[model samples]
Target: MSDHKQNPLSREMKTHAMILGSFVAIFWVTELLDMSIFRGRLDRFGIIPHSLVGLRGILFAPFLHGNLAHLIGNTIPFVVLGWLVMLQETSDFWIVTFLTMIIGGFGVWFFGAPGSVHIGASILIFGYLGFLLLRGYFQRNFASICLSVIVGVLYGGLVFGVLPGRPGISWQGHLFGFLGGVVAAKLITNEKRFYS
Candidate 1:
C-alpha cells in the first residue's frame, strides 16, 4: 500500500507521456486517413504562401506530412525534444507549441516561395530545439543550464536546417519556429520571475 502512494514526479511523467503519445497518434492517424481516403487531398490544407485560405493551415500544417518518410523523419525528434520541454513544466509544452505554430506558420506564409505548400512537424521540432537551447540562458539556473548543454550537444546539427538551401525543405518554417521557441522561453522565464 505504501509503495503505491502517490508520487508527484511519477504522475507528472505519466501525464507528459500520455499527452505526447496522443499527439503522435494523431499525426499518424491523420496521415493514414490522408493517404487512404483523402488521397493526399488533405495536404491542400497545408500552408500555401500568401493565400488567404492558407491561413488555416497554421493550425493544420503540423499534422500533415508529404509521405511516410517525412513523418518518420519527424517522429523521433518530436518525441525526444518534446519530452525535454515537458520536464520543467507540462504547461510550457502547450505554450511553446501554440506560439511556434502561429509564428512559424505566418513566417512561411509571408516569405515562402509562391505556390509552395509547407507541411510536416519539422517546424515544431525546430521550435522545441530552440526552446531547449535557450531555456537555460533565460532561466539562469544550474539544471536548466545542464539540460541546455545536453540538448545542444545532441541536436546542434539541426541548426543548419534553418538555412535556405535545402531543396523542397521549408527553411522559413524552421527559422520562425526557432524564433518562436526563443520567444516562449523568454516569456516563460520572465513570468516565473515575476510570480516568484
Candidate 2:
C-alpha cells in the first residue's frame, strides 16, 4: 500500500477550500483596509462580549484580530480546516461551514457572558474536523474512519484553545467555534449508516 495518505482532494473539496479562502482573504484584506483607512473603526466592531452592544460583534468579529499575529493565528487553521471540509464530496460542506459560524457565534454571543464575546477558527475547524471524521461512519468508508481517528489524535491540542489566552485572544471564540462544530456535524451527518 502507498505510504502517503489518500489525497482527500476532490471537486467538492477543492471548491470548498477555494470559496473559504476567498472569504477569509477578502475579510482579512477588508479588515486591514478598515484598520488602515478608517483609523481602525473596523476593529471597533469586533465581538467584545459586552452583551449589550456586543452582539453584532459575533457576526463579524472573527474577521478582526488584534494584530498581524492575531490575524495569522486564526487564518492558518481556517484555511486548513476549510480546505479539509471542502474536500468532502458530501453536499453539506458549505452548509456546515456557514451554519457552524451561525451556531458557533450565536451560542457564544447569547450564552457566553457579556464580557466574553468569543471569536476564532477553532469552532469552525473542529466542526470541519468532526464532520469529516464522522462522515465515514455515515458513508461506510473505512478510509474516512481511519482519517478521522488520525485527525483526532493528531490535532488533540485543539482542546487547549478553549482556555483563557494571552491578551487580545479569544479563547471564547475557540470554545464557541468548537460547540458550533459539534452541532454542525450532527446536522450534516447522515444517519443511515455509521460508516457511510
For candidate 2, the per-residue lDDT at 147 reads 60
Compared to the true structure, candidate 1 yields what TM-score? 0.96
lDDT of 1 by residue, 1-196 (tens): 5533768788888899999999999999999999999999999999999999998889999999999999999999999999999998999999999999999999999998888899999999999999999999999999999999999999989999999886989999999999989999999999999999
lDDT tens digits, residue span 57-168, model 2: 6567666655666667767767766665655444566676776677667766665666654544555776676565565665556766776677677665677766776765
What are the runs in model 2 whose C-alpha is more than 4 Å off? 1-14, 50-52, 115-123, 133-140, 165-167, 191-196
lDDT of 2 at 2: 41
Count of clashes, each model? 0, 18
Return the top candidate by lDDT: 1
Best model number under TM-score: 1
